[model samples]
Target: MYKRAQYQIITERLKESRHFLQVVLGPRQVGKTTVIKQVVNDLMF
Candidate 1:
């Protein structure tokens, strides 16, 4: 599975709407997109 170290932190910030936008970036298959997608998915629940 895709993973990273900072997903939780970024996800938390997203919940708060503390920023206008959150950008996830990294090498392919490295979990940058995964983190944001996870955040979005989690928010729906």
Candidate 2:
């Protein structure tokens, strides 16, 4: 499986901190959006 580091981090944060809002900040094309998309997809299933 292709594991994205950011994806893992986001998922972990979401699981660990349900009350806090998670934010991803970086330059363009740095996979911030992609990570969120992947996280959302995983959560759906």
Candidate 3:
């Protein structure tokens, strides 16, 4: 799981009014998908 600080940072960046794509990559089971889901959930469409 990502530390709260890091997750918030990414969330803040995504909140901006612009088209942005973030790519997360690492070894399998490193929580990349989990983090992406968290971000998507936190971000209101």
Candidate 4:
């Protein structure tokens, strides 16, 4: 499995608390959006 560090951390947090509000903060072009999108997609399936 090829997972980014941020992706893994966010995935674990989401699994721990599905209802919690998740905020991804960072400067431009840092893969913040990408991580959340990937996580959301994974959770859907």
C-alpha TM-score for every candidate = 0.61, 0.80, 0.62, 0.78
Worst 10-residue lDDT window, candidate 4: 13-22
Candidate models: Cα lDDT each:
0.71, 0.82, 0.72, 0.82
Native-to-model Cα distance after best TM-score fit, residue 24 in candidate 4, in Å: 0.4
The top-ranked prediction according to lDDT is: 4
Runs of candidate 2 with Cα error greater than 4 angstroms are: none
lDDT of 4 by residue, 1-45 (tens): 456689988888888845698788889988787788889899899
- Give lDDT tens digits, candidate 3, residues 1-45: 445445776887777888598666679977777777777877755
The lDDT of model 1 is: 0.71
Runs of candidate 3 exceeding 4 Å displacement: 1-5
lDDT of 2 by residue, 2-43 (tens): 557888778878888456888789999877877788899998
Among the numbered candidates, top TM-score falls to: 2
Model 1 C-alpha lDDT per residue in residues 1-45, reported as the tens digit of each score: 544568678767776845657666678887676677776777788
Count of steric clashes across candidates, in order = 0, 0, 0, 0
The TM-score that candidate 2 achieves is 0.80
Question: After superposition, which runs of candidate 4 have C-alpha atoms over 4 Å from their true positions?
Answer: none
Better of 1 and 3 by lDDT: 3
Winner on TM-score between 1 and 4 is: 4
- Return the lDDT, model 2, position 16: 84
